[model samples]
Target: MVSSFSLFISLILLSLAKGIQGATFTVVNRCQSTIWPGILANAGSQPLDSTGFELPSGETRTFQAPPSWSGRFWGRTGCQFDPSTNQGTCLTGDCGSNQIECNGQNAKPPATLAEFTVAPAGGQDYYDVSLVDGYNLPIVVEPMGGSGGTCSSTGCVTDLNRRCPSELRVGSGAACNSACEAFGTPEYCCSGEFGSPDTCKPSRYSEMFKSACPRAYSYAYDDASSTFTCSGADYMITFCPSSTSQKSANVGPLSISATTGSDNGPTESGDGPLGINTSWLPNFVTGSSSSPIPSSSSWTWPFMIASAYLLFSSF
Candidate 1:
């Protein structure tokens, strides 16, 4: 019977090419204005293909995701909407989803996440770029071709709404609120019992957002260095990422030197560490890593996994 129906349609196209071979997420923006990005897909992943759109300022937008697939992405700043019922609203990551498509809705915090998971069979693909639900703008997450050795690049291209903190600014500045949205209690909203992490620790406005985005994820257990990993990767996700300087005329406050680990330089500290008052950080905004995840020894990935298992046993 025609070679068993062409080996059952080539074994169903190699099992749908293993979910289209997972990962590939591009999403640049380089910001000058025009934002709207949003995505959600987490609790039981699978939803990629526009969960929101409109990029504009230097556009970019690629997609695809299937293997483990987890998500979270943000960027919505100052929107308007309403070109005939497209509804509107957004001054910062709004995912109340009036229209721009955040169908599964999520980002509605001070907003500035990236988060990912991927990796199912090729394994290892965590990622990060959160501001612990606060910090509207500046994101990074590079990782390409990924194959371990830690596949680097994480973000927070620091423009911290011009150093917010006249009580988490937000209006004249546009976004920067998250001392648990300006002091809601439970000690900056770790919650109820300061909810673990051995009872909420970091806070001086999350150590000045961890001294200006030191690998993002500033508060909420921070996860060691704000988690990062890669293996069989492919992700770009830039936003105000050209390596800092997203408009700054020195908004003020920055005696710096909050001391803590190293990224090769500055880490001093004096009247800091919760003693607060490092002027308020007029600079620190670090981010610079994008090269690693190269190590490959040959046999072309075991000869393409034994030629896809002998073409799925000759289908």
Candidate 2:
């Protein structure tokens, strides 16, 4: 009897160690500040733009998978805060000099930055998951501040190589009131008053006057504007485990480019706007691990198989 009991105990222990399942899952909280419920019209001209939704303090938005949906999840499509609006626009507001406008009021803000299991149901070993802006636009992952250096004029152009001619100019289609900031490549600056010619201040005041006007355009620096320096911009980061053993990591690190102005880089394929194609992938993930899940448990075969089986079975 004793021998039989020992054998049975050993078999149970072996089964628990080998066939017992563990999971490697993922939790993602694609948190961002770009998704405002109401249209952020031309609030740029008002202090409210700097302090309100146009650029609220500590305000954040998130995108997540709904309760009834399953499959490769995505959200925050073309997430943008328009600064202008036309007639018949129901949802109207302001960003500053511009008026916020939208066609409807049912626009949902992006989901909150959350960590949902990506591996399997009821398993703690989650895949490393993170929230990202659609097309990974930096503006969406990490939005520009009301005083973002990107829109600042009179700031430094750190990379002289990328700088447009000191005397570059734009056409009437992009009027002076809307003329590009002399601080950055001759791109349109967010102006105080619309429909007039605006000129960037001479190089002398580039640093002194940057960020003075919340909605104005200026150059970005690594240090002081006068010093032609700036710190990196902050990123909205949220991480979840790949396994029960992994811990969550949520951070909003400021990521500085070699220089500012990359935000305004031309599009890769289309002439849609004056900025780069950043709506798909964020710039911060450039050299980091690009796996969809966030933990180390995903490497185990049993966990992988179990997770796949469970996920497939649900479908």
Candidate 3:
């Protein structure tokens, strides 16, 4: 009878352990240069391993996220930091935190973003790679292993920076600006008169982004095709996935591995991820604009005690 009680307790503990296991995110840098990936947890959400970290060319790192986690991730380019003061800046996607770690800050405009909200109550994990802020690097979010529902991969596979319109270009052709960022008008920003889906329609500039990457969020109201759903899955985020060879010709084969949490935040190397030593590319289009851009469960300890007593009494 004592052995039976011990076995039951062990089983309960094991079940609890499985229930608390969080989803893992494996971030990969396929660019020829190094990228400092920044993370920002949503308000009231638990934090992850680190707010930011440096990912060298062709290197991959993994971090875990609690169930029901919600956050955004972006790559910083042309960054330089001072360790002593924890102050620094990046040419693109800078969070203006004055430190390597973002410290719960979101990235500035004209940056690519990967957003996620994982459900804990056995619901679908909602994710999307968004160019609504603009585009710097091509990104892909792939599911490692999960069952049920459509766990389809989503990303901006096309190189939008090289093809960005002249008016919406930023920082030595390293990044592209969204219509709303370049021109802060209500039309482009979906504000004032154009606040709702009915009021705001897709502009030519937003259409350009949608045309390039149909699976991504091209504008503020792009939800139908942009958002994706998956359940109980690990994700792989790859930066510069398409142009891996174009920039780093001599880079070695990509290596992937899982890693435990670390304290080292993102830092800059000599060359920036966007400063690819390639020929200058021509511009693409024109635009007019301006401005802008969890569940629970229940259980009772008294019920558990009553159930245990009943089982032991039966024995």
Rate residue 128 of model 3 by lDDT.
Answer: 95
Give the TM-score of each candidate. 0.32, 0.19, 0.73
Q: Per-residue lDDT of 1-315 in model 1, one digit per residue for the tens?
A: 566566556656544453357777888887898898988999888788889988998778888788899988888988999888888888788889788998998988888899998877647879898887788788877776566656777777667877767778778878888878777788778888888889887776776777666667878887887798877667778888743347666556422335533332124662233332222131221233433222122223554565556655765
Give the better candidate number (2 or 3) by lDDT: 3
Report the CA-based lDDT of candidate 3 relative to the real structure: 0.71
The local lDDT score (0 to 100) that residue 261 gets in candidate 3 is 22
State each model's CA lDDT, in order: 0.72, 0.24, 0.71
- lDDT string for model 2 (1-315, tens) is 555555455544533431132211121233233322232112121111111223232333332321111121112222344445422221212122222332222222111111112112222211111111001111112221111233211111111112212232122111111113333233233234422233323222222112121111232211222221111111233211111111223312112233433333225562213221222332322224453333222233345455445544544
Off by over 4 Å in 1: 1-20, 24-48, 51-63, 66-72, 75-84, 94-134, 137-147, 151-163, 172-174, 177-213, 217-229, 233-315
How far in Å is the alpha carbon of 175 misplaced in model 2?
14
| Winner by TM-score | 3
Clashes of each: 3, 71, 7
